[model samples]
Target: MNWKNIEGLDGVESPGLLVDSDKIQQNIDRMIEIVGGAEHVDRLFPHVKTHKMPEVTRMQVDAGITKFKAATLSEAQMAAGAGASEVLIAHQLVGPKLDRLATLIEDFPNTKFAVLTDDPQAADAINEKCGDADSPLDVYIDIDCGMHRTGIPLGARSDALRAHIDSLSGLNFAGLHVYDGHLHDPDLQQRTDKVKEILGKVALHEKEHPSPRIIVGGSPTFGIWAAETSWHLSPGTTLLWDFGYGDAHPDLPMTIAAALISRVISKPGEGKICIDLGHKSIAAEMPLEKRFQFPDLPDAQPIGQSEEHLVLQTANAASLHVGDIVIAIPRHICPTVALHSHATVVSGGRVTGDRWQVTARDR
Candidate 1:
C-alpha cells in the first residue's frame, strides 16, 4: 500500500518497520541510569542478537558501551566492524565456524573477541583454529544457571572445564558467563531472589577457582543484577522492549523503540479487518495476546493470521478504513527485527534520513 500521503513518511510504504532513534538513545540512557551512572556504562555487554543492525551497535559504542554479546559469528564480526572494542560470541561455535572466529580475531586486531564454550571438544576446536592462526582468543566458561540450555553445570565439573580452558594454548580463560534467562517472574523481588540463588552457586565456584570476571543476567533480570551485584550485565531486549518483557516486568524504565507499521488491506466480515501484518511481520513465538499489541486499536483481537494477512476482530473495525495505518509492538523484538531487511528511522515524530539495514540476519 502507498504511504506517500502519510505525513513525514515521504518514501515509506506499508508493512514497514519503524525505529525511533530518540527512543533508542533514551533506552541506552535508561540502562546507564539503572546501573547508577555513566561510570558503570562499561559494565554493560548488551547482546547484539536483539538488534543486529550495525547502526544500533555504533549507537551503543558512542554511548560508551564497549563490550557486546553476539549469538552468531556474523553478529560478532558486525559488532567488531562497528567499532565495538570487545565482543563475546555467547554461543558455541564448532567446525568451520571456529575457523571463522579465528579469522575475525586476525582481521580485527584492535577489537577483543571471545566465544562461549561448555564442551572441551569445542574449546579444543577453538584452540586449534586460533593456534593455526597464531592469534589467541579470550574464552568465557558458559555456566548453566538452571537454564539447562547450553552450559556446564555449576559445580566441580564446571571448575574442571575452566581449568581445562586455562591450560589451552590459544585460549585465555577470561571469566564466567552465567545467563539466567529462565527467571522471568513479574515481581521484582522474586526475580531478584532467583538471581541471587543462582549466582550464589557462581560465588561458590569462585571460592575454589576464582574467576577473573563474571558476566551475568539477560533482559528479564537486568535490573536485579545491575542493582544487586557488580558483574558485567548482558541485557539485550532492554534496548528495544517487546510486549512479552514489558508486560512481565513493568518496573523497567524502557519504551518501545521499534514498531511494525501495517495498513488495513481488506474488510472481510462484519467485525473483521485484515491488516498487511502477518506472522512474518511480527514474532509468533508467544501466544496471541502476548505476541503483539496494537496501540491504535487497543480492543482489536487477532482472530487469524496467515502468511501475508492478520485478521483482527474488534468493534472499532468499522472506524478503520482501507489503507489506514496501524502501529504494533512485537512481543519479541529480536526475531521480529530479523524478518525485515531494513528499518525506517524515525526521529522527532517524523521519518528522518534513510532506513537502517538489518546487517546480520542470516547467521
Candidate 2:
C-alpha cells in the first residue's frame, strides 16, 4: 500500500485535510531515532504548531516526549491538556496574551509553561502577569541570529537583559532560544557549516553563563541541531512535513505525512480542469503555481485560484473527470492544515472515518 493512497477515500468529503496516522507515528519514531532514541527523548521539544492536534501531542507524550513548543496559547493549552510536562510558547506575549499566559500557567499547574522574550519591556510585562513568585513563569531569552524576525542578538545587551529578567520575582530566566528558520540550503554540509558558525557564538555565550537550558531551530535545521549535545530541539514540521521542506531537504528523512483532497468540479476546457481546491482550501501564501502539486498529475500547471475553485492546465486532464477526488501535497502544509477544522484520518492504508480534529488550528 502506498503511503499516499487512502483506502475508502471515495467517501471522504471534498476539499478536506488528509493525514496518515501510521505515517505520523512513523515520523515520531524517526524523530526519536534521529535524536538518539528513548534515552534522549527529553531533548525533543517538538513544536505542536504543525499538527495542532491533541492526538499527535498525546502520541508524542506516549512516546516519552514530555516537552513541547507552541506558537499560540491555544496550542499551548492543547499540549498541556495532552499531558505535556513542559510547554513553551516560542512567541513573545503582548497586550492580552500576557494575561492569557497567566491563565494557561494557572490552569495546567503540573505543566511548566515558558515564553520567549527579546524585549526587556516585554519580559517586565510578562513578569507582572505571572501571578506571583511561587509560580514564576519560565522565560527564555530569544537570541537573534541572522534571522532578525525575533530575538535579541547574543551580546552585552542580551547579557544585561538576562540579568534584569533574573531579577524579576515572577520570571525564571530559562535559557536561550535561537530560531534560525531563514537558513535553508539544499546541501546538508553547507547548512551544517553555517550552524557550526552560529554555534561558535552560542558556545562563547554558554561559556560565560551556564545552568539555564536552550532550544534551537525549526524542522529545516533540526538535523544540525540534533548533532549538537547542548541545544534542545523544537522542530515542528517533522510531524507532518509538506513539500516545501520535503523538497528542500531530502536528507532530513521525514515523510510527507499530510495532504489535501479536492474534487475535480469542472472540466473547463480541452486541457483545463478546475478543482474545488482554492486559496481557502490550500495555503495561497506561496505563488499560484507553487501552492500545490498533484502527485499523479505532477506536470499540472495551476493557472488561477479563487476562494472555492482552482483552475489547472494539464495534459493529464483528459484522463480526469468530474467528481474525481484529487489528492494534493501542499507546498506549505502548516497554513493549509489550519484551513480545515478536521482531517479524515488514514490508518493502515484505510480511511478510518475517524477524524483528527485540528484542535488548536487557528488559535
Candidate 3:
C-alpha cells in the first residue's frame, strides 16, 4: 500500500506507525480457518498476549471465540472483562500475583479463570485462596515435554502431580500445557516431526490422567495440537502478522502488516542515510542491528542503528534527502509495536486517518 498518498493522511502525519487493519483481520480469519477444522476440538482459544489491543481481542470474541490463553494475569483479567468467557493464565501464578488473581476472580465472577503450575505448593495456595473466598480456582499442571522453560517433566512425576491435583478440593486440574517454541524452525518437515513426537507424549499423559477438561498447546505447536486433540490451540502472534515468527515459512500468508514509518533525518556519510526511528522505535530483540526495506526504494538496506538514528545502505542515498519518509519493517512485531502509541491506518495509497492505540504498552 502506498501509505503516503492516502486521502485523510495527507496533511496529518509523518514518521508514524501504520497497521493494515484488513491484513490483521485476514490473518485472524486464516488462523481460525486453520484451527477450526480440527478433528473433534471444541474451539481454538487463541492466546491474547501477542496483540494486547482490546479492539483486536474483541474482534476475536465477536467471531464466536469465547476461550483465550493469557500469558499474564493482567492480560487474563483485561480480556475476560472485555468479552472472553474463559481466560487461562498460561503461566504459573505465584508470589504476590496470586492476590491480584484472587481480586480479578472476585471482580469477574462469571468469567472462568485458570492458571498453570507444576508445583504442588501452588495447588496448596490455590486451595487456601479458594478457602478464603469459599470457591474453587481452576488450574492446570504444566508438563515439560522437551521445552525446558517451565512445567514439570512429563513422566512418573507428572502422573504424581495429576493425582495430587485430583485429590485437592479447591483446585481443579483443567488440563496440560505443552509449548514447543523451539519447533518454529525454518525446516517444515523437521518441525512437523518434532511436534508429532512431543504431542504423542502429551496424548499418552492425558490418557493416564483423564482429568483435565482443557489441554492447552503452546503457540508454535498450535496447528499440530489442533489436529491431534479436541482442545484449544493458544496461537497469539498469528493475529499480528509478525515477520520474525513466520520467518521459517516464506510462503506463509501473514506479512508484516505494521511498519515503523520514519523520515530521513540526515545524510551522514558516503552512500548512507540516517532515519529518525532507531532502537527506541523498533524492537531491540530483532536479530540484526538494522533492517531496511521499501517497496518504492527496494535497493536500500539497513546497515546499523543508534539510539535515535537508523543508517541504511543505499547507492542512491542522495535521492532520499532530509525529510524523505521511509517505512521500515521490523524483524519482530510484538515489542516493535509496543514502542508506538498509535498506528496510522492506511488503505492502498490513501491514508484512512484511523488511529489504533498500542493497548499493551505496560510492562
Candidate 4:
C-alpha cells in the first residue's frame, strides 16, 4: 500500500508492479504523434481507468493531454481532482449517483463533465440533475457499432437522442461515442475493416447530426483509428502495456509495467509450480487460457488458477525453488491492475519510486 520514493528496493522486494518511465513516456509520445498532436484533434481524452495512478495522469497532462475518459464517477473525480480540466464519464451515470456527479461538477466548475447514455430514462435523469445544478453538461450518444454490450442502436434513434439532449435545459450535445470492443481479432485487415464499418455507420448518421466531436478507439484500435482521418483515440492500456494486446501491437512502447511478482510459495506436484498470486492478485479472466510464458520455463502453461495460487505446469519445474521470485504477466491489464494498490517503478534495473493511491481499485 506504500507508494512513495522506493528509489532503492528493486533487488529486494519479491515481486510488484515495475514501471519503466522511459517506455511509459514513449507510449504517450507515440500516441500523441499518432493522433497528430493536440492542435489537430478536438482533444486527446486518454482514459485513466487503466493505470489509475494520479502521477501517471499527471504525466499525460504534462505531455499536452487535457481531456480524460473515466469509466466510473470515482475515476472522473480522481482525474478531475488531479487537475484534469475535462472528463468523460464513459459509463452510464444511473440511480442515485446523480448527486455525486453533481458534486463533482459543482466542485470542479472548471472541469467540463460529460456522460454517455443509451437509455432515455438515464438521459432524463442526467438532464434533470444538470438542470437542478443549473449547469450545462456535455452528453454523448453511445453508438452500438459492433459491441452490443451497451450503446444505443445506431440509426434514427441517434437523431432522437440528439433531439433529447437539445431539448434538455442544461445539456450540451457532444457527438458520438462508439467503441468496437469486439474488434480484437489478430488479423489486421479484419480488425481494420470492422472498425471501418462501425465508423462508416457513424459517419452516415453524422450527416443528419453533424455535432463534430466523435470519441472512438481503445488501446487495441488506437493505431488503426490513427491510420484513418478525423477521429480521436482513447487509449487506456497504452500507459501500462499488457501481455494481451501488447503481444500483437509491438509498435506500442509500453510494456508489462505492472506485474504480480510472487514467490514459489508451494510445490504441490511433480511438474507444477504454484505462485502466491492467483485470481485475487491478477484476475483469472485472461486473453488466452493456455498462453502464459514463464521466463524460467518458456514452455509452461498457465493453465488453472485458484484464489491464491497460479498453477504453472511445465517440464522444468525443478529449476524453480520455493523462495524464488516469479513475475506473472497478467492476460488482461485493467482488472489485473485493479488488484494492486500501487506500482513499484523501476528504471535501469533500479527502483526509482512507488506510485501510490491506485485510483481505479474499485468498480
Number of clashes recorded per candidate: 0, 0, 2, 0
Could you tell which candidate, 1 or 2, scores higher by lDDT? Answer: 2
**lDDT of each residue in 1-363, candidate 4, tens digit only:** 121223465354544555666667777787787777657544477899888878788888888787899998878988887888889999988877888898888889878889898877888899887654355788899988767799888777878878887887778788788887777877778778888887787777777767658899887778788778577678888887777787776655565655556678878899988877667777556443633444445677775777777777878788878977666666677777777777777665566655567875665
Please report the TM-score between candidate 1 and the true structure.
Answer: 0.95
Better structure of 2 and 3 per TM-score: 2
- Best prediction by lDDT: 2
List model 2 lDDT by residue over 233-341, tens digit each. 9889989998888899998888888888888999989999999998998889978988888887888998889999999999999999999888898998888888899
TM-score of each: 0.95, 0.97, 0.89, 0.90
Candidates by lDDT, descending order: 2, 1, 4, 3
Determine the C-alpha RMSD for candidate 3 after optimal superposition of all C-alphas. Answer: 2.7
After superposing all C-alphas onto the true structure, candidate 4 shows an RMSD in angstroms of 3.5
Q: State the lDDT at 199 in candidate 2.
A: 88
Candidate 2: pairs in clash: none
> What's model 1's overall lDDT?
0.86
- State candidate 3's TM-score: 0.89
Q: What is the C-alpha lDDT profile of model 3 across 1-363, one tens digit per residue?
A: 564544554354545677777777777677676676423224777887766777777877776677888887767876876788899888887778888888888899888888888888877877776523345677777877776888888788777887887788777767777767666767767767887887677777667656546565555666666666666577777777555665656534564566667888899899998888778877776445334356566778778777887788788897778977776666667677677777776656566767767565663
Model 1: residue 221 alpha-carbon error in angstroms: 0.8
In model 3, what lDDT does residue 110 have?
81
Worst 10 residues of 2 by lDDT: 1-10
Model 3 residue 156 lDDT score: 84
For candidate 3, give the lDDT of residue 93. Answer: 73
